[model samples]
Target chain A: MKGFKTQWSPEEADRWSKEDYLTFVISPLIYFLLALGAIWSLLLLWYGWLTLGICGLLLWLMIKIIDPKLKAISLDYEKKQKEFLEELEKIERWEN
Target chain B: MVSFAWLDWFWLVVFIVLMIVCGVLFYRLGKRSLADFFLAGRGLPWWLPAASVYATHSATDTPMWVSGVIYKYGLRGIWYTFFSAWCAISAFASTRIFRRSLAYTQAEWQTLRFSGLGAELLRGWIAGWQVFMNMFVLGWVGMAMGKLCHYLFNWPEWIGLMLFSSLCAIYVLAAGYWGVVMADFQQGVVAFSVIVIVSIWGIVAAGGPQQIMAKIHSLGESWRLNPLAFSGWTSGDFPLVWFLTMLVIAVIGGFGMGTSIDWYPEAQRIQSARTVRDASYSIWAGSALIVARNSLWAVAVLAFFSLYPRIQDTAQYEMAWYRLGFEFLPVGLVGFFFAAVVAIHISTISTHLNLGASYATRDLYQHYFRPQATDKELVWVGRVTTLILLLGSFLYGLMMKEITQWLIFALWIMTAGIWLPSILQVVWWRFNAWGYLASWMANLGLSWLVVWVLPEFRVIPSLPDYLQFWIMMVLGALIYLPITFLTRPEDMNRLVKYYVMSRPLGWWKPVREEAIKRGLIKPERDLIVGGQP
Candidate 1:
């Protein structure tokens, strides 16, 4: 537990970058759109927009609800980890 | 009936020799510990795992399966594979979570995240089912490769199965995860290049892409290009609604719920990634490759339709890609093409063998039997388990005749049943071992009732495959909820530990508060006013 860390270490969150946002945000959006657009186009081509529209609307709703929560939870956890590591370091210095 | 040229043999021999050499180089690396054997010491760069993930999905039968779907339904048939685009959820959400869990296997994650006898039971259950699923996949791919050998050389299918099983087992048993990844990298590149090349050849043979499109246009079967166009219910091809239903299941059920299902080998890759970012990128990169590969196959099948317009038999339709390989590839390259095909088979089989043996040695043997076994003893157990699993899969391959039917059950039906439970395990704190077990059992029994028994009895209208899967998913939820509430909750300490460690962004309000009080973590920036309750 003393040295455990994740790629999104809390110590770096204060210095989060445009690149981080782009990688975490734009990249996934572009990728999913490219993948899902193939399906959407196929659906529209064969079954019309009614089917595609319904799916698109539902997916939009799910993403809207889920995305912010995922971001908040990740940030919260990283912040806690940062504090936890600092606490451990303080204890070690006192013992010395 | 395709015959390989001498150069094909030459390429295959070379491929095998190089693969064995990789096995020997990595042999010492794998002998260190269970982690080294199963997870490559978590030392792989992103691209290696990315390539290995792509290679694992490109089993020998993948092209045949794609060709068959296209022959029946057109290019839209690509949707069937792309349905796994649900993996996009994995790339986004679960990659970091999986890395943070720090569990050896998905089964082992239960102990990390849960508590007491219930977590133990849950661990054993997951480990057992995963082992069974891995063996079945290994055998299914082995059978397909054996049949391909028969198609190419008229050799006894068993001989080819034996050769494949023996060679793969020797390397995989010796070198473990290092061998699996390195071999997968080499094989994935060759297999990908060969498929693309052969497909381009087919396109040229049919006077290029424009001519193939023109030929399709002349036939007035443009419906093939539309991914959503389904033949009517009685036509055997799924209907339009079924396609939509599958999309919903793939997205909502697959992503919104348990994005991290028991894709055991893929899970190993995620764990093996050098960083969490590497794990995330690997999934997206691998999926992009799969998408590219599917498109290439679709184009090849389109050309096949243009060249052989009258071959309508289903069996011949499925084998049309192979026929194209034989007809279009030149003598010297024909062997190279066949070798690439063998490479695909070996990559897939090797991963399954290595993954399955890990589950047996770690979760089953070590956990229950020799909890204090030395690293040397564990690696020995892993090697023996690899050989035994390979032998079992070889026999299973021999007995299977209809590879497609078994594949459907393995891929869709089995997954649908377990999907909900897997999701709940991560997100919901109250979901205990009994709840998971009941969900699995209920999905199995109810799925049989819907897919098989009801149809046989004509109790109601026989549903389409997609409908049946969705219904079972709903039924799984119904079964899980009651069992979870009725069962006692897990030990609270374990719950808090998992909560703070994994930090799963779900319904863990109490655990977070407790973690703060215990000095496990500081309060959040936006904590409630006067938060120390």
Candidate 2:
């Protein structure tokens, strides 16, 4: 680990920031549900049976909880990130 | 009954005139300074941002998507992703949060909160990923439009793709965010007015809403009540659990400002709004768009299905929309119809390009190559970065992964990995950073494993998607929650500073004056570029 005197690297911060943007933090479940619905749609076509409805409801129940959960985590991330920034500011501040 | 052929021509002229006017206006403003070019100099008001949100989001795929559902599932079709509308609403509701923060783009938030290498790394990765996704995934949207045009107008896909991309890129690249926002407003108006007119004409042709319902009833009960009707009931063909998962994925995985953070125009546009009220109002207006945008498409599609017998191929399915416009509407109206679709395509493409490139320049290039860059220099780099983005996106268009499947499945999976833990931490006060990280990585690793190890899962006797959704959420939460307490709490001083500066409501202890006087702490009141903290 770097010593307490180490200065912050904007480059590293930017790298993580880019990762944050591209990570798909929130949409995988949507695509998964789409896949499920699509698969069930195919099933209905092949066998003339209706199943996506049942599966869809269950999927909805499962994914619905995650949204609020995502919000909570995001809020927390903001909090932590805030704290981290503040701490850095303090350590980096010159007497001037 | 309808003999106003000039209305069509008039609307078409209006749209073209408006678009050209937008180009001209941007050309003028764009020449002034970088502020005008990139962020409209933070001078944009509520309406333009709201209009951009609506216009850029109302893509060509959406209409076909709505029709697709109705063609297959009936009224239940509306429920397919209708929950996303709530996401739009929530985004607006929280518009103040973003605007209040005063960051030009979401990536800038990384600097405000995390200053060191961690922040830089975060910024770089998120920006790179956003640009990459926009450059790659969004190109397909234009390509799809090309495919649609080819089906309808007998043009080649490449021909239409090049034409569409060139138009959008030319103006967007030339004008930057300033021009795009103005153009987006015009696009929104055109899209709304045209769709409404087309919808009225459709209703008339379908013998009105009552007849449309009657025809739907003729098909089956599911056609009427089943699409958006259920709440719960697992294991059945249309179980509540599956419905629940769909809703969860929409919010958690799809909507929660996760996954595609770069795709978030809300924060950026809000930053440019003249005031908090303007920002909030613009966001709220955008929220209202969710009410009918998707459903409108579904309604249009179902109405179309009511007329057509079979939707055999993708080409036929997409073409039928154009055919309806061409067949039912008169000359000017026909032109409006054409313009609206093209407008939607351009608006979306422009947004993706601008958003993606902003990340590349701001988060990656600026953060790394020139942290000391002047505003003038940064603007040039941003412009050059956009050019590089265009080339990369073009390449992505030519050769890439099978997003056809990702489009169907992986989008939300990526969201779960990218966003869930971070979102969870914000609300659950006890959720430590380590726990959030664990949740993110755990979800990602397991999901990745599923894709790699379980090809058969794709099509077994029935590996239920709901089952996967349910299991993943359950396991992800279960694993992450316990880990929260296991990790160290965030620094207390930093917490206090954030609450004070951002004025976010929280329970951390207030900063004392003695601490500031002693030079042991920084005051929250003095934090814009960087807090005294």
Candidate 3:
């Protein structure tokens, strides 16, 4: 939380930053933890619960770090999406 | 053969009707345009496409595949199904980039990413291959259902294949992806609930979790409970090296598009989401559900193993989870289980029917043949292509018995040789269309040589799959890297446009600098915060 950028301008969010890098690290760990945790917990293993709890914390942290950037990116991107879509059609039809 | 009571038949018929009706209700929405037909108008609120992703990947043969691995290797087998974890990083990485580009399919993305003849050729090749691959997958999955039905009711495999796929086609043909996604939601719910019920039932039938563990220990197989248990560093079937290789492939591969075959259908889901955030969450949550679902099936298979430890035959043990349901669930619930199976079957069928058609209609038909096709006409083309794919699947399903091994080999070649190139095409701006194309061609020939031809002639030993992956990757780079440097990079204008749109991660500094120089984007130091620069 200290180092991760929580707030972003549209242009700032458009560029990859430490928040994105942190997410790249955190997201996969959450998946691995969720997977093994689900299996072990179903068998009533204690460590399984702990693993899942950690996974939850990491998931929260990941969202906190990346969600703002994504929101900014999405908000700014949607404004231009119509223009982008038009360009896409031109490419599809070989008119470009 | 298992006998279904009248109640069983009732549940089956009711579920079929419900699924078809749910899908058909969206016919008007699907007929609105090509986007509506293929993508639900790209306005879905994350969860719909999330459910569709979960349901589509949970095909009829999924449990059988899961059961086979879990039964054979205990907890370690979950790693075998862990390839879907690519979505983990992809949710934040490639998924975001692809969502921004807004290509209808991966094939279409090619022409958007590259320019000129090479790009066109790549698009055509990928589109044709996707059409063929989807048909092949449909046949393979349909035949799996046919085999299960034959096993259950002594019905001919063809009847099982034709009956259910055609039934699924009714909704897909009527409503296209709207039908596919909506029905997938209902089917995802049913399939997931049934999976939980049957797995818990199987656990309780094995005298609950504690007793199952005790039995496993008493049977001197406690290692089965340890997820970290490995046979050896690299020699045994469940090797540490192989597990590490899988982790690299699954997790790191997420940064690239088309790294996993699952990315094709997922590309549709990615575009269907209303926003980039929605696209990211849908892929992440959907695959999160899959990871958890596989764990559920793993535990259930372990329960079956504890109950019947001496079973040695692969085919018999592969039916572990299904046997847990039909052999153990009560009479009326047996029908419910079968109905859920139908749900699982058709969810996959509908997705492929629409997915293959998306490639056929969007990339091939409209892009190449009928660029002037209207939205209404394109929607009709989507339907016609869906029908064609369905019919093609039935034929492939009927003949699948003799060609399964070869097609699987074909799939392996598709992944192994081009894995790095698929990633490079995203992260490295210098990875051009000719380089990508050359990788495919080189991999096709080299895979045959390394995997089969040389081994057959005693020129080399039969290498392990993980070893083959590394070898083919190095070998493929030998060809593609030279071709990449020899050929000029993709047109700067095209690269700049893609860079501005996608903002792709990794090694894109040159493109970013160009975009900045062109005043297309601002330098990071000039960023305005709170509307003040």
**For the second chain of model 1, what is the TM-score against the true structure's chain B?**
0.94
State the RMSD for candidate 3: 1.6
Fnat of the models, one by one? 0.03, 0.00, 0.75
Model 1, runs deviating above 4 Å? A1-96, B230-238, B253-262, B526-533
Which candidate tops lDDT?
3
What does the lDDT come to for candidate 3? 0.92
**lDDT per residue, candidate 1, B394-461, as tens digits?**
87888887766676666666667777677677667777777877887887788778888988999968
For model 2, how does the per-residue alpha-carbon lDDT over B322-387 read when each residue is reduced to its tens digit? 556667876666766877988887787777777777777666666566655666676667667767
Q: Rank the candidates by lDDT, best first.
A: 3, 1, 2
**B376: Cα error in model 1, Å:** 0.6
What are the per-residue Cα lDDT tens digits for candidate 2 across A8-90? 22212211122222223322333333433432342234321233354345434433433332333334334444454344333
lDDT of 3 by residue, B1-533 (tens): 79999999999999999999999999999999999999999999989999999999999888988888899899999998899999999999999999999999999999878888899999999999999989988998899899889989999999999999999999899999999999999999999999999999999999999999999999999989988899999988888998998898889889999988899999999999999999999999999999999999999999999999989877788889999999999999999999999999999999999999999999999999999899999999998999999899999899876223544475577778988999999999999999999998898889999999999999999998889889999999999999999999899999999999999998988888999999999988789653423
Candidate 1 CAPRI-style tier: incorrect
| Among all candidates shown, the one with the greatest TM-score | 3
DockQ category of candidate 2:
incorrect
